[model samples]
Target: MGAVVLIATLDTKGPEVAYLRDRLASLGVDTFVIDSGILGEPVDITPDISHGELARRGGMTLDELQHAGTRGRAVEIMRTLVTDLVREKFALGEVVGGISVGGVGSVMGAAAIQVLPVGVPKIVVAPTASGHHEFAPYVGTKDVMVVHSIVDILGLNPISTTVFDNVAAAMLGMLRAGHPLGPPSADTRYVATTMLGNTTHAVEAMKARLAELGYETVVFHSNGVGGPAMEELAAAGQFVGVIDYTTNEITDPLTGGIHNGGPNRLRVVGELGLPQVVVPGCIDFSVFAAGQIPSALAGRPVYDHNPEYALVRTPEDEMRQIGRIFADRLNSATGPVRVVVPTRGLSIPSTPDGPFWNPAADAAFLEEVRANIRPDIPVETIDLHINDPELGRHVAELFSTILDSTRPKEALA
Candidate 1:
């Protein structure tokens, strides 16, 4: 592990930032602080890289930004610079971990998410972490950690001091427990899988079965972040095959759910020539924040998913659009593919006699997919629900067969 990157608007929180940096130093973790404040003068510690370097790297000048007389321009340039600098440092193995201390609506927190990759130790200390619901714009699919400061980051007070000490410790601990990504193993290729709470059994079965097939299973939750991370990494050639058993993110936008992973959800893996076995695991319903005022999904069937999120049934019309999206993306595949539809159910509550059960909608959804899918691509219907333990085994068998077929003649029996 290298120096922990500390970022702050040093012009305002210079003394407080110094305390944070020194606190981590006391714990034996070296600190590299980035200055992002444009309005005031930085004090005490010299910035390794200043706001001038950032603006220049962003294809602009600090003078030009000043001449433009807009703080927004400064914010934009600093974000671009920080993102570029952080990524460069990470590639050079200079950043082992990172922390950004910012006030409400600071672009610094959002930039932290942009710069850091999935597993790197990244933390953002901000007031928004205390219950801010508008999260995806800031976090996206990154694995950055966040801590609520409970107070604005100005001159250090008891609460601010306490928050700073706790955050420093957390960052130090994360760096001490270091993690570094290894080169992809050639002995066993990666198999990416997706799972929701509704499909946990299927994922467990798939993981064990794929292990026996000599393929490592990488499961991504179909949450807002996980789906995007899996797809992007797949395009980067991280996985040899994908058992995408949970495609619920596709319908999230159609039904106004917070878990909507961007629209480019299924576009990457196909373009990368990765073999895949897709499933309609839990596309039947959309999830909404429970207890809070729900999205304006009038007349749609809704059920309490948990205390935090509510589940709502997808209309046949929206399901049809999702079907077309599936076909359109899969049609571009340069490798083998499969789409599995569990005939009895799509989710736990979508099965017959369940709360969200509506056979008509399910039939409409499946029929559209079956009809629109490329003729060469096979779409199979299983007689079980998506969560049924056997469905996992069934999908695993199909995926293993795909892997076997792709093997060279000399590598096969």
Candidate 2:
């Protein structure tokens, strides 16, 4: 690892930024401090992107971009510039690790670093870490470490110095630890798999089978964050294939369930064009806020596994929407794709005598998918239940076939 770049708004936090730069020097590492503040002149910066370039990229004059802006707007503009600059530096292998310091400013700068490929040491020392729930998840997903600045960023206090010094030491240690993007291995190709508590057995089976074929499997919980994080990894080209076992979150999202997958859930398969085999594994129910269940559905069927999780039978109408959404996302694919439907039952709760065991709803969902999906796309419907060993085997076979089919044939050139 070469010199670690210390990125911050050196205009306002000059003293604090200087401490971090000096601390890195003490540890026998070179440091480049870049100033991103557009309001005032920078105190001390080695390789600075001037206010003029920031304003030019931001489409505003330096004075206008600074004076007309609140802290948030300034942060947003700075973030855009920083994201572009950091990506460029990373590609050139000039930056080993990145550290940012500030309250609002730190979040913006850290966010830019977060956009960098994972495994690079990313640290943010911010006073707002305690209440930053929204930004925290993005940081965690990207493996960016956030350290709480004990005192405010107004000036350097004892606590502030201690915290910043520790952060500097940690960053130094991370840079020295290993090179970013470690030595390549022939046997390991990361495979991301989605699973829920109900679908864990099938996923485990599939993972074991995939491992036999010489691929590592990363299992993601089908909760809100898990699915998105998996897609993120896929977009980064880290995963070779995806076995999406638990499509339950899409049901939650469509039927106003509490655990919706948002708009990005199934889009990654289309965007990245990775070999994917999806199933209607958990589309049997619509999760919702306990009190939000409709009057018609209030007593039809309900199961409360815990305070945070409750299952309600999905109606026939809701299933049709789920099918359309599923088919629509799948149809947009330019890559190899497969949709598997377990006709007998999609989840444990959808079996006979279970609370959400409604075949009509499941049938309606599948029918809509069959009716709307592109003819070129393959939709496989199996007779076994979702948890069936045979169903797991079928999933493995489809993924294996699709992945094998995608490998480039040799000696054509």
- Highest-lDDT candidate: 1
What C-alpha lDDT, on a 0 to 100 scale, does residue 371 get in candidate 2?
98
The runs of at least 3 residues in candidate 2 whose Cα sits more than 4 Å from the true structure, single-residue gaps closed, are 10-12, 38-47, 50-52, 67-74, 136-140, 182-184, 187-190, 248-262, 284-316, 344-348, 385-390, 406-413
User: What's the lDDT for all of these models?
Assistant: 0.79, 0.76
Top candidate by TM-score: 1
Candidate 1 has an lDDT of 0.79
Tens digit per residue, CA lDDT, model 1, 260-289: 877788777877788899998788888877
- Ten contiguous residues minimizing lDDT sum, candidate 2: 132-141
Off by over 4 Å in 1: 43-45, 66-74, 105-110, 137-139, 292-295
RMSD of each: 2.7, 4.0
lDDT of 2: 0.76
